[model samples]
Target: MLSPDKVSAHADEDWENAGAGDTIDVERLVAVVRRQWRIVAVCMGIFAILGLVYILTAVPKYTASTSVLIDRGNSQIANQMQASVAAALPIEDDASVLSEVELFKSDSIGLAVVDKLKLLDIPEFTSPARSPISMLRSLLNFRTWFASDDVAADDIDTLRHNAADKIVADMDVDRIGRSYALSISYTSTSPELASKIATSIAEAYLVDKLNSKYDATRRASEWLQERIDELKQKALDSDLAVQKFRTAHGLLSTGGQYQLLSDQQLSELTTQLIGAQADTARARAKYERVKSIIDNKRTDAIVTDVLDNSISNDLRKKYLEASKLEAEISARLGPDHVQAVRLRSEMAEYQRLMFEELNRIAESYQSELQVAQTREKSLQDSVTQASSVTAAAGETQVQLRELERTADTYRNLYQTFLARFQEATQQQSFPITDARIITRAQVPTAPSAPKKPLILALAMALGAAFGGAIGAFREYRDRFFRTGEQVRDVLSLEYIGHVPAIDAKEAGSGNKDPESVRGLQNGNGITNYVVNHPLSAFAETMRSAKIAVDMENTSTRCKVIGVISCLPGEGKSTIAVNLAQLLAMQGSRTLLIDADLRNPGATRAIGRHAEQGILEVLLEGRPLKDVLLLDNKTKLAFLPAVVKRRVPHSSDLLSSSIMVNMLDELKAHFDYIVLDLPPLGPVVDARAISPMLDASLAVIEWGRTSRRVVRTTFAVQPEVMQKCIGVVLNKVDTEKLKLYRSYGSGEYYYNRYSAYYHEA
Candidate 1:
């Protein structure tokens, strides 16, 4: 069972191991950026300077703007006139405003401005119209005799087109929101020219509009005039034809109800026949009244005609006078008197006259009725004859009515044309435009280009981005080991400890003689380093290596520990020697063997001048004690290799049965035998003897050797890798590691516990 601390420690180690693969940590990236800040600053400064230079050298341009008010004028007038005929158009929207804006920037305006200002005469717009690249090519081809310097006609036209296109491109036309106003602007090097061009474009647009309206009015007037003349002639000819037709038929009446001659005769005869019929009816009624008076003897009942007659009234008066006379005479004489008889005779004569009058009146009525009947019959016959003639003339009347209708149409057309013609003439004389210039352009007071501050800020931002990229690249490019964690993680090996770099003055570990220490490289002979500086961080690191080796060994008696390196100058010998001495000081019988026949650094470090050591023992059967050097102070023993003969294959010699036998024999006497072998990179000596040793340890120079080299070596020799105990990250700069908080060993272990240790 493990404690919580132990379990946490194991988990943390596993986490760190997992993180050491291809995955990059954010903290490490930030650290790398911080470490390379000086480079980033330099790059930013350079970019800023370039921006400053451009801001100083860039050309300045002036912009001029003109405002135009565009009303729905012409469209309104057109709509009013064509209301009944034309389709109703939608009110102007954003698209209509944009169309106007495009018109303001169109080539027509450009051409007009060019002509008005004589832009072709100006060098700015016309000279060197060909692009610089094209001109350069033409110049380059000038050495050939047949190379034409004359521009083609089409090319000249194209150049002019490009110039016009440039003018349009430089002009900006923007509608002010939804309002009917446009802001037209142009940019140029010359302020006055820019202003002039802006103003001219606005004026030109107005003139073009007026011209369009005038043309439309002229067309309408011409069409109306021609139509009016044709209508007047047609009306005159129709009226004359109608008059001629009336004269020929003798039916001349100006009103529509008037009839032809035959129709009038028929109407008069019919009226006469109706009068005759009324007379005949009255006469018959009178005759019937007389008959009733005579047959029924009702003399007192008078006829209506007699009552209405003046002669009958007079006759009735006379009869009454006579009867009065008769009565007087009878009273005077009896019967035979002459006077009385005359009176009676007068009365009787009056009565006879009254009867005769009544009879004559009746006869006169009868005769009048007969005459009326004869007249009615004749009139009836005449009416029938006239009706036949009128029917025959009905077709002619239809023809005449058609001619009258045609004449009315012509007259009406003439009146309409005349009215429209007058209107068109008035409009043509005074034309109106839809758009007018609201604000005239003026010469600009200040240049409007090459924004300096904005350019500088952008340059700085770009520089920072590029610098960060460079920093990231540098971090990825560095593939060497920097901490103990890297040795374990990158190479998948156990990490023992990391040895702090020894100062030059304290690094001569095995050189007991002052002269030998001075002669050593950086005075790095650290064979007695643990004994001399027991309390120092370097010595503590060596103790840590010893502990790791002890913990890794499972054998009961002895552990044959082989110290190897992937490359030379990695401090493997120093680590092995110091580790063995540290074990000896702890009362372990340890032997430090310098088994590297090639470049024996340990042999030289201990000041051993013996010409024969492991090589002589293995080849000549020399006893090991004869070449073994023992440290008297720490009682540590080491067998140093002396070069007695140059062997071609050192790895083969190290793998010999004799050397294995010697190592086996020594293993029984010592508690721990540490062998410092040659680096495994240039030769296979370590791999050759790895089977003979119990375990092997690799020494990697911190921040120096590449992890790939070590990992590849182990990969090639699986047996050696299996026998390998782990690695020690040697020659670490402890002070530098403290600054790099991202380094796992430094941040979590060394820096945290640095104050706990005291200096030797």
Candidate 2:
């Protein structure tokens, strides 16, 4: 029976392979780009050549510009002309200048330029211009040159319209700030034609302006002349009516104004009535004073004028003397004496005479006052009658004044129309415009298009971008492990080491050696590189892989390491042979078994006959040491297998109870046993004997093996994968390892230590 201790320990060392679960691996992607950078460089070079060809063959084009300055100098004409003429012209505002810009690009202006310069004959305006691409097309196809030329008369108009459109499209008019100036630029194949068209457009605009102003003034003159004649006739008829009305009313002017006859009589009577009223008042006052004195018997109290008469004054004096005499007589005689009586009689006679004189004076004053009052009343009645007659005549005077005002109004209107007619006639003879050309157009000297530097710069940038994108896409689609990290990340297995490719020189081949079927051939028949090149880095890396396998085993008994690969040519047997040699060189007893009955690579390398290998011991039930070959230099033993005699398949012999018992018996003699199994990718031999092994290691060809094939190896035969301990990335290219060093840790380590090993 197989040793239970070794069998159970090997079972425990088995681990899941990468394909046991899915995961994303990016390190392998970066390795693909680094490995295929040459392809990307080639693609970019091709694009650069194409760009150069296009730029060199492109046709050269020219453009020309001309400027015209619009100065509103004609605005000064408004100030020089009459006010009415100035009011009729358009004023220059911001809107007017912008309107002129639109007019400069107008179809009318474009058509005028086309007609003046006969631009329809130019091929660029009438049809599409010939470019480099179009010229190439015409050369390739003869049908393009024989295109139809027949068209209707309407097509000629259409052609002219199209030419006008092209002229307008190629021309640019720009206003200079807020000023009335323009920069007119035109693009064409000929510089002279562009400048000539620009100049003609400006001249056309000036002529159109002058004609517009002249027509407006002529229309105004004709309308005014008709209106003036009508106004003159109306004025004359109004003056004749005013004179006729004045004669019919029989009015006259006393001052500078006309007056009625009744109004004159009323004026004279008013003056006489005022004088008679004053005389009547004075007479009545004198009569009242005198009459009052006579009625009261106060003859002495009468006014001086009433008593100024001599007879009244003497009577008053005589009465005073008689009173004195009568008093003296009465004192001498008795109170009834005849002398006193006779004196009193004389005084009475004098008093009666004075009273009569005062009465006469009062009567004269009363009669004169009554006569003055009657005359004043009669004059007042006459004045009132004359004033009523004058009021009636005032109505006719108002009508006469209205007729005179109408005549004056008609005369003033006739004079104003006559003045306007004269001004309109003057405007017709000398018309003015609101805009004038300050500067004429001139030919330009340079083209303004097809910037070559910018085009080439963009072309080179695009080419590089396209090449990079293609490289990235190739990287994404690659399905292989190119770095040592892919062993761990993509395959989901532990990484043992990176083993550089061992060439014939490094393997130390000699003339006396036997040739091998497939391996690094060296003298002495496929010499173990680890043992021959002892101080080399490749030998050192094999030693490291031996240590890692040894660490995983950790058993005092025989440690069985099964070496396998996903594909047949991935160098698994070489790694196993070298690893066993390294372990034996360390003074440990090592056994290298060639268990691949189908393809015995190690059996052939050791120059041992295949019939005397493990199949003899297992099938014939022979002794354990009967088929073993020992090497003296490394102290390693090898049991090589021969495929000359075949059974049903390799798995039948590998999985048999005899094979297990054979491995168990050898465990007591060897410290480690390395099994070189057939590739797991193409056969089931590796999985069949997995349970009998301590641990398994995978060997991959760097940058050459497919990741999908390796994954399928573990996925289909999971039992073999469970016994796998780790992986070894073999046959690495050191220069490429340095380039893709950043892709994985194993590549970086290999690049750093590659110099330690010298190549012949």
- Top-scoring candidate (lDDT): 1
TM-score of each: 0.60, 0.53
* Top-scoring candidate (TM-score): 1
**Clashes by residue pair, model 2:** 509-522, 509-523, 510-523
Instruction: Give per-model CA RMSD.
Output: 16.3, 17.8
Going through the candidates in order, what is the number of backbone clashes in each?
A: 1, 3
lDDT of each: 0.76, 0.73
Weakest 10 consecutive residues of candidate 1 by summed lDDT:
514-523
> Candidate 1, residues 339-406: lDDT per residue as tens digits?
76887787677666667667877787778778877878888899889989989999988988887788
